[model samples]
Target chain A: MTIRDEHLRQALQHAPDRLSAPHENTSRAVLSYARQTLEKEQRVWWQSCMMWLKKPLVSNWQRAGVGGLATALVVMLIFWQMAPEKATWPDAFPEHAFNTDKNNAVALMKDKNAAELNAPLMRRKARATGAPAQEQTMATQPGHVIGQGEHQSIALDHSSPATNEIASAPISAPAVVAGANDSSGAMSSANQARGSGSQKTEAASAELSEAKPVKKDAVLDIMQLLDSIKNEGGQTVAARDISLSKLRMLKLDMSTTKQENSAPCLQMATVDASPDMETGYPVLMVSICDSSMQLINGVAEYNQQMQDYWYRQLQKKNNER
Target chain B: MGESITTDEDLMRKFCAGDMRAFELLYQRHERPIYRYIRRLMGGAFNAQADDVFQDVWIRLIDARLQWQPRENASFKTWLYTLAHHRTIDILRKSGREVSVDEGWLDDEPGSPWQSWPAAHALEPEQQVFWRKAGQRLLHCLDGLPAMQRAAFLLHHEDGLSVDEMRLVLNAEFEAIKSRLRYALFKLRACMGAYLPPMVD
Candidate 1:
């Protein structure tokens, strides 16, 4: 019969039974802990509510709704806190140490040398234990890992030794900040000097030494500035108008290399980068120009032939339209 | 008993009214059953994680006591066991480790624990050792049961809930409920017959 059968029920009634008497101390201990926790939370909520009453952002009607939302977000954040960290890089990348076992063919030619290399094979047999593989790789390679061609058109304005060159980049026009409250060549004095018809460029690198809001629209603004400078600085037309494609292809070392002052932030002087057209290795050019097309510093390399070609093409399209 | 201690609800009301002694009495009545229930339902599968589940179950009870009128129809013990059951089932489901619930596995079977009586007297001592043994034996028998059958049996037998009550708990049909209980009892008797051999009180 099954344990639920009447015979099994009768058998079980007399079956050896173990009963646990609760420990008075532990019971008291648990009760006190629960009470204290609730009391503490109640006190904290009251204090925060009092603070809110003094200067409230929420309306009386919206108070409960806001509190509920905040509570939900807090609970979500707590759950998220318990979640395992997701791997930052895609998983397909070769195992970080997979390349280390290279063919040192010549070095290991000798039979004795081969034996020595294999000596520690047993001792070094350490499996990746508790920590994850991602952690292992991160623990090894500690800095910015930019793949070749991944961001050729991007500027990593980092302060490593290479960025000192960026501070003195060849300027071909007055640097115009399109969104700058005043693009009246204030941030451009450095640009006019670079475009002074001098093939022999001077090394005048200035690094803005201050924390500035890194703008996502900074590249677009820079492109607009190139256009404005080309039109306004008419006579001082130097090389070519910076196109969006060209800007995308070019990477500025906007990474803070040196600090000149707080307000004068994020300024990196180009070291000695030849104009991309000249070197064929993509170059980032910074220029400063006035509304009247005056070159304060930097180069105004606006290619007249290209600009005219684009202008005529546009005119043709407009006529068709 | 004079000052209103008819049920767990009464004791809880007294406890909430600052009667520390009443709270002690209630814990004495429940601590083992809840712990043993948890041990049986999720022993070694979540053995290390059992302490955490135990603490969480009690914390939930503490919260329930602070707010609700305790219970009237479903005893506090049954309610607590139900919470433990639901929480555990949810945990297993979330981990994607549990199998699909098939009522066929629980369809009418015989020679199970709930079908007979001798099995109920399994735990004989609690002073020092058998209490611990009972917990282990309970977990072993439960692990041997099909998940649905196991859940049903616990709801009906250990939890002392009626078939209708179990229908609500398992969300199963009335006929399906009977089958699960039968199947669970059959499996328990087979698994624990040696551990719960006939004995006299």
Candidate 2:
């Protein structure tokens, strides 16, 4: 629009345009250097570690080792589980030597595991007192027998014809006779034989010669035992005799008598030969019988309170004398 | 590789994408202008120093290939000139040379461009002599101008850069570049007005 603007534009338009060209060598040298650098990076050895990480599948060695370990572990566990355990006795005591009934009797001489032999006793107690087997084990507190005693027997008076016939026949003790009442009465028969026969004979000889130590003057805790029986809901039987030294066998009548009848059945003598808990004492011999004193096959509920009461009375009488 | 029709920016992108052929085309197209820029910025000395700066500008372009992004308004020519301008200034500064922005020192000088003129006519002999004198006087005036003003003038006239694009190339404020170009034109007009061909009326 003005004079200066027109002239200035014309001057800028005619400005010198001289510029020299770049030499040829410089371009070729720089391009080659860059390509070499890229190629060198591609050829490096450490890139293999990255390639290994990028691999998708597991290697064959890993699969074989892991699967083999798993299979061996499973097989070992199955074989270990399938192996059966053998029952072991102490090395000093041979297993076969104690397998006979005689050694079984000796093993039970302490009577600690008399309850293991309690299946027949359980059945007889169930029959006599109408109590459950578990309750019978809780109710009965067994006492030991004094050495060389004249055995007194108790019988349940059953009016059944078969039991009446068994009641009519009586067997002398120190003899092995089959019981007439039931197969479960076989233990009572064996108890009768053992109490009166060879075992008692050997025990009396051992006591007379002082070859065996006799445990005497032990505390008789009949009250706790009677309470356990009374808690079991049974009739309190009375014991007429209290001479524990003269007492030996108890006879239970396992006659097929229904327990609903409330009769004075257990005619046991009250004898206190109770001992310390750790003392291995035998269960007093019990003979199952009917009214005629026939050795009947049975188990009887022993009324411990009546026996303790009578035993205490006898002790009082002996002290007075 | 035919560079006549291809845009500078497209060739820059192709070169950035690792096409060496595109880089060669781009270098050929830009090398002369960038070299002249450096030479003028170096006070018109076409020496080893100027050649080193010239090579450095292209080398910088090659190194920046991975980082180049196509942008709006800033063309490849502007970017190339900017690299040449900065490298030249840096070399000048490192060598402790001051760019003469002082137009006062240029006063009382007679050999300035446009001292005499011959109108465009059928008089061929006088026009050729006038043209040579005009070119020489222009070179002399440019040499006398300040480094930054000369850069602004050259980037504007030689590279055809607008004020904003020259802002990017000069790495300068818009008004600073605008003023520098204005001052540069004023000095050139005051110096070269006499020798320019007369306007055809």
Candidate 3:
């Protein structure tokens, strides 16, 4: 601010001005270096990308958002791959070949007999077992005289003429009948029934022959009743969908039907028939009037023994007379 | 109409975009001031390294063109001087010269080499001679001052920087710049006063 300070400032300014300028060569060299560097420094595409990545392109919030979105996408993809596929109706119900429309199903059940409705299924099963489809249908028909053991004969009153002839023929030797009741007692009953002719066994056989027609009629009535109930219930009886309550109700109905008949003993057993076309579930068939057979949970060995004893007694009386 | 004068920042931007003429203009504009800043800061003993340091400063400015941003309230000249100041300091330090800018050197009593010189008579010729001698002595006095104080003095007086610009160039606090300038002016005055005759009131 003072004269002395102002003078010193001026002196200092004038003293150092233009005192130590760089030589022309140094300036030329620096410019030449700049030119060389600018011309030659051509970065490749990947190098440019790397440079961009190395720089802070986004803020902390943007980075977090991007990371979270990527993580969520990955998790969703993993879950989508790991999830189980759902079973469609066709996969669950292989018998989709049968009518699915409620009205059509009821009409079909009403118009067709059990044999006619089960014909397709029976054909499939016959193919699987390597048996003729006609033979299988005839074997399941009423009054077919399906014998269980070598000496045992079952006679129904509605018997076909050929089956009636076979039932009435005298047993000279053990006969190996081809039927659905292929039980283990088949061969053993021939020897067991040789010398056991009791009066009770003969009387029971006569009673069975007399009541055969009633039993046949009762079985047909029960089948028609069950078909009507199934149609009214608006549900097809699939093998898997048949609950225990429905089976119990069927057993109660059969017991009522038996009470109405003159047959002293009525037995039933649930046996697996052919597998369904699509679902592969075993079709359930209820065998009635076979004392040698037992319910699903009953002791088959005891029932078979009892039936074999009765059969042997009947065969012995036939031999004696 | 007057032609628009292009600012240093504009020239630097044009240089960054590959205009060699802009760079040449920039280099020409700053060459003397920057070179003298290095030379003065390095002092007479390290004068040989000044050219190298000066070239390094310009080369650094050239290399850093891409990274340069026009700072708020600071010019390209301040930035250039800053680079020169730092490079000169680095060279001095690497050469093992005493580059300390601490205030410890301020307390050292002024030498009496100017005491034996005869007084100038009150004539224009003698006055001119006296002032010329004083100018040469001022450069010598600048060499004796501490690096930071000398920088403060030369930056303000020679390069015509304001106090704030000196703060940016020196990378020091405002008050620190003020104190360094004050000390620089005081020391230069004391040194030059030894050559002045007794005041005639």
Q: What are the TM-scores, per candidate, against the unseen true structure?
A: 0.36, 0.42, 0.43
Residue-level lDDT tens digits of model 1 in A176-230: 1111211224335434422341211111111011112223233234444454554
Number of the top-ranking candidate, with TM-score as the measure: 3
Clashes per candidate (backbone, < 3 Å): 95, 16, 2
Error of 3 at B65 (Å): 0.6
Give me the displacement of residue A176 in model 3, in angstroms: 71
* Order of models, best lDDT first: 3, 2, 1
Docking class of 2: incorrect
Clash number for model 2? 16
Q: Mind giving the per-residue lDDT tens digits that candidate 2 earns over A1-321?
A: 111334334443444544355566765665565455345446556575445544667565445444544664564356336533221212212232223232111111123244344435434534564544553443233322222111111121223333222222321111111111111222233323333333323333333334322211111112222222233422232232112321222322223121222221121212112311111112232222232221221112332332344345545665686
Q: Which stretches of candidate 1 lie over 4 Å from their true place?
A: A1-29, A37-321, B1-4, B14-24, B66-72, B99-139, B192-201
**Candidate 3 Cα RMSD after full superposition onto the native fold (Å):** 26.0
Please identify which of the two predictions, 1 or 3, would achieve the higher DockQ against the true structure: 3
Q: Give the higher-DockQ candidate: 1 or 2.
A: 2
Q: Model 1, A102: alpha-carbon shift in Å?
A: 99
